[model samples]
Target chain A: MDDAPNSEHFTLSPIGHMVSDYPDKFGIPRQPGLAPAANAKLVLAAPYNDPLAVRGLEDFSHLWLSFIFHQSPQRWSPLVRPPRLGGNKKVGVFASRSTHRPNRLGLSLVRLVGIDTQQGVVLALQGCDLVSGTPVVDIKPYLPWAESQPDAKAGFAPQTPSLLAVSFHPAALDTLTQRSDSATLHALIEQVLSQDPRPAYKQKELASKRLYGVRLRDVDVKFRQRQQGEATTLEVMAIEPYDER
Target chain B: MDDAPNSEHFTLSPIGHMVSDYPDKFGIPRQPGLAPAANAKLVLAAPYNDPLAVRGLEDFSHLWLSFIFHQSPQRWSPLVRPPRLGGNKKVGVFASRSTHRPNRLGLSLVRLVGIDTQQGVVLALQGCDLVSGTPVVDIKPYLPWAESQPDAKAGFAPQTPSLLAVSFHPAALDTLTQRSDSATLHALIEQVLSQDPRPAYKQKELASKRLYGVRLRDVDVKFRQRQQGEATTLEVMAIEPYDER
Candidate 1:
């Protein structure tokens, strides 16, 4: 294999694109399954349109999505600094789930809500971590019996996220109230922004910015940033639903 | 990134070599952590032997080994047929844990029993699944709290393996009985071989072979193939301890 060094390249075409309410990368949970109400729709491509391909899928409550981080434009390094580890300690790229790699593949387990085959093929998913319009290569049904091992230990991320008392500004709540499924959308926005998604190093720049907004599906979510020493405080600004051109 | 397609290529060097009892790949488990007692040692290269590099390593009981599969001489395909899935159902290479990948980098979590820094760093590990002389590019301590998700679901693999009664021929037992800690070695051999490590398609040629031997550590394990109607069996032949020339 080492004799011919140039003979190992391969390519892949995305089978579909994931359309999620998440329009930006910053506020999406660092991990999937953290927000169960964040909805996304996977629109499948043609020739792979066979409805039979999705048979026995309804039995699974979640799926493993194999995807590519097509946007990352960097070469892989043997070692990487993970954000979860404070981005100072260097760990092997394989050990950390870094987007940069020899191959840019990313795997995330997301909740499967339902499937629609009427117009074409669409898989409704929740707790999606991908940005809107991210390409999806493949999906496999999650097998609970084989996948779950209750005895396994987790290292740095041992603490389950402490539930916070979330509140929204009156203006932001009014703006969200005008949308369909306003309650669901409000909960998602609150849950995501509350996690303090800014890079750890950017904590200072974020503190002074009073109004920060993220464009989501038909909505421009605006929020205010507050700093309590090292931790961040977020107050909702307003939600502007999408307006057609 | 698209403008400079050829500029993305990079090279890696082996930081160390893996020395395992299993000299060949024929009977090795498809994945590590399957057989916990199989041991191996890693010999580290110079320059990386600065005692400071291995600081804080003894805290973990296992490590994540990043290595290359230097044997298989084939280009990768987008899809591969996994032997565990009967080799009939084709799954994307990314979805299945197949060795044939665009880049043949392999990752295994092995039990780290000891780390000797005094003499050119030696890592004694258990549950090693690599073939003898495999080139290891990097090693990082496995943080169980971050890496292990007992609640996570596996995709297609069944939760529990079916029961099978395993026994060795009297002659084979006699040969193994001569070794120190023969009980552990016997159990390791039985557990590994019983998994039927042969390729799914090799049944036709394998059926006629009466005797097969695997060399590991200082022993040559010889066994005979038995078939009862549809069921297959492995009868032990002889265990010849290695004699260094």
Candidate 2:
């Protein structure tokens, strides 16, 4: 018998597309489980929607999602700047979870909230960093015993990044209160801003006045940062309906 | 602009093939790290063999390998009988790390022992559960802080499977002593058999005498089980070269 198996290339179609709260990639959390209020749904495609495909998925509390970094640049480099490493030092692409890979594939672990099999299989997920409409190729249940290694040493990101204090002005709070889904919007803003979504170099600058806006659902959230001694504060300036034409 | 991303399919090619000690699937460990003595190498293919593809990978102690379960059966069932569950109780295919799935993909975490870039890039791996000739698609460094969750609960496989005691017959030990790599061969047999690689149902049977043989490298290892009160002992009867014609 031949010792070597056949060497062949394979192709796969997207199994589903994720509908997430973040309309664009900017301000998205670096990893899942960082923003619990951010929820998404994986809407299955034609042939993959059968309930049989996900029969025992509910037993697993978390899942591994193999997705495409659709919005990232197409070309790949040997080294990349990781946001966790302050985005200045270049590390090997394989070492850092950069988007520009030979294959634009991204792996994420997300909490599995529920699965709807009524019309089709719609997977409810929480704490996802993927932007809205990300194409997901494969989904596998996370096996904690086999996958987790709590004592293993982490090279660069040894601990979770410190969070910035977030507060909204009365004008922004009043606008959020008038919205039908006020609680979700309020939590989404707090979750997004607490991560201090700014360029790594810009993060250290104290009191530099620059307003940033991130689109979430049908709203535009405007926020600014201020230096408070050792800690940074994110203040929500306004919240208004996003105009698209 | 529409918030939804373009729905498109993606294709991937095998980056390399694993050269493992176990020629067949039966004696392979159920998970990695079960048999640390067993080693394998991923010999890179064209294009992927470029050293730049794996630059800085040595910095990581472990890596996540996405591979194909090429030798598994073509069809899959929603419910699969896991050996951990004694092969009687059926659970969702996603819940268990069954080889058969909608896609023939398998994921494993292996220790990076070394990398040979002299002729072509060959990645030396330890504690691999993959069978020989398995196709590997992608390799990513494992970040312990993000990937490891020591506190996470494991549903079915909560702890390492119990090991069976093993002993060698006088005749078998003499035959192994004549081999050039006797030390390695001895350790291989002991490591492989201690996992009790029998069918889950057969494990409970007290004294049913059945001889079994497994092929590793260029040799065939024969062993039989004998019950010792509550524990089972595997006695190696013989070790001979595996002939291929």
Candidate 3:
């Protein structure tokens, strides 16, 4: 274009950091709302924590969070294979919501529960698929009138990913029964496993099953696939404290 | 909170920029899709323009552009008066989608028409409410199933903005007849004027009607409020060449 801006780039400071249910990227859902048990909150710092900055925010039920893929490698690739496409066919980074893209920027639509201003600006959120400690740059109320479109065409990823049946092994069930927060942990584990957290390549090789573990909260959840007749169930083998080093 | 990432900030480079029907910010719609005639395109540069970067993008009907509000002032205010709230009540910057936010970052959802690879990657888009020369940092295909929620609650802005009735003066109609692209210009003008481009404060002071001009393309569109009893119509008084200096 003849009138493009001369300044090619700019810098921004993180307004705060996230505290989410997913401890790492390994098991996080590919998209928000895929795991409703995945709760989160943004803990503001320094100049951004003023209560007045969040005044009248409760009226909005959802918000758009602009965040950074801080954990992804800084180097970016033009084309990437999305897990939704079976991690086989290559698509542009922009075509697929891959973390390996220019600028490493990301967007997540999360439900707004409420705000806690006792210690500072702590925004309680739900259905966020981000890893804990991710950097958040900006937050904007979701304008449903302008944003919501039921008839939109979503190419390769047409619908929510199909779920895999989940069950617990005897030892894992025994461990859950001993914990006070068993219900919460159980629900979180069910939500995480149903989405099948295995790498895309492994997801295809269902016949040769193996153990896979992902850190959720403070426990490492180990699970493997069990096929019986026509149905396949992802059975949780064990849940051990992550500090067992 | 104990696991918050220590890294506080980062920098980014603009992968592309915008060329749109909106020449300036004064008359631009507050949100995307408010004015469908507000067409636009993104001109990508350098490594970002590789055709491989946009492969498989054609399948998706819409995209989200994360851009910098380069035209807005660098400084930010904690409180802002949104036109939706009658411009009297103040809300926190985050609570409202005002241009003067902390990072000056904005998100726009635009319909993708197609891509042009004659020179570099040029994205043809529609329903964009951003000004020309916008610095776009990232582009992601819109996933409707997760994002579309008609039931979500919107605080201040609950619906599409109401528009005033529009009509053209005799002189303005005469000018339109001489233009080769009269149909395109006519549709653009009607879409813009009906939204009532006057500042929020002036919108309420309807009785003291006066002339207002906004630059669209290479023409200066002059208009004013006309209250005919219970009906209030915005009348276009003139359409003169933009370079009248």
Candidate 4:
């Protein structure tokens, strides 16, 4: 139509950056709250660090963070196969919350635990799905009454993704005990490995016998997949301090 | 930290534009589902309009629309006074759902009524707050389990904004009777006026006695404010077709 409004382009700058436990995308939960013990913080930058800016933020229990899918491929396709859909059956990119979107923007609902103004404004967030050092473009308080629709159908992913049973060998348990934050570290590893972050296509296949390793925080978790009845299970074989070299 | 990742810049092209009754920003509902009667259609652009791109989208009752605030000022403040807080208290732009932000990007959850693919894709959305012809950069089906938080506390405007009692004068009733879509027009007028879309500063002043008008759809609604004790009421005095001149 002649009255149609033209779309205007704008440049966006990061107001903050996230410091998360998951160094790479390999072991990060697909969504927030899935990893309750996952610790992260949004460190504000420049003018955004003013303490007065977040005066009333503590009252809200949850917040929505809009961040870029920094590691996703730049090219986007209209249709994508969602891992939740067993990586089969193509669905529209708009239908699935795939990161390969027109704009690689991601929206995640994270629990707001506390705000630390001692060293600038760092929002202590729990259950974050972002990888370490992800740039955050925007944040907004999650209004429950207006946002929640518990009964609304979720289409493909209707229920919470089933979790895998995780077990650690004696050697792995001993390594975990050596850490100063042993209790917290153990819980974090169990919570993360329970999701079975293996590729969707590999979920049903029998054990490949390959020792798969994923870097979480400052440690490298080595695990192997084992067939458990109708489901697959993960066994932690080793936990070694991450070697940057 | 030396390991901190650098923020990368991205350029996004709009996939669609909305056509709605709200021509300007003045009386638009601050959030979606606030104005259920406010009808809008997101007409998809080329490439994005492929029928396959919308497959299985209808199964989801709601969708998340990522749009730009085309009319907002280019510059943003770290803190802003939200009208819900009586426009007195300042909250971080991130803590409040303010339009003026680094990206000018807004995420709104809208009820997806239907999808028409006969001539390109046209999604019928209800309870959307987007202005007419607003550019839509991305659309994703709202996953209830992931997005909803029924019990989370909402700061400032915790509950829905209160509605005011609206009455139509005899003259206004007469004007409505002459309209072809009288029933729909009457409902639209009632739905909009009930919100009491006045400036926060002007809402409490008793009996301003001034005739206020707002444009909804193709009509200019003329009404007056009357204070009834603690509650404010609106009386529709006349309804005139919007004057394009």
Measured by DockQ, the strongest candidate is 3
- Between candidates 2 and 3, name the one with more favorable TM-score: 3
lDDT of 4 by residue, A16-80 (tens): 88988888889887778888887899998776778876778898999989888888998888789
| Docking category of candidate 4 | medium
For candidate 3, lDDT tens digit of each residue in A1-245?
45443446587888888888788899998999978776688987657788878888899999999999999998998899999988899999889899999889999999999899998899999888888888899999998888998788999998989999899999999999999878888988999999988888887664756999988878899999887766777999999988632
Give each model's whole-structure lDDT. Answer: 0.65, 0.80, 0.87, 0.83
Best TM-score among the predictions, by candidate number: 3
Error of 2 at B64 (Å): 1.1
Model 4 regions more than 4 Å off: A1-7, B1-8, B243-245
TM-score for the first chain of model 1?
A: 0.87
Q: Sort the predicted structures by TM-score, highest score first.
A: 3, 4, 2, 1
**Docking quality category of candidate 1 according to DockQ thresholds:** incorrect
DockQ of each: 0.15, 0.43, 0.70, 0.63
Give the per-residue lDDT digits (tens) of candidate 4, residues B111-180. 9999999999999999888888788888888877777888888878788888889999999999999988
Candidates ranked by DockQ: 3, 4, 2, 1
Q: Give the TM-score of candidate 1.
A: 0.68
- Order the candidate numbers by lDDT, best to worst: 3, 4, 2, 1
Kindly list the per-residue Cα lDDT of model 1 for residues A1-245, writing each as its tens digit: 12232333333456577788777666777677666668888876654444545644565566767666666654666566766666677764544566765446666768778878787678899878888767665665554443443343434444444443456889877877677788888778877876656565654474477566666566777777766676656777777766631
Which pairs of residues have clashing backbones in candidate 4? none
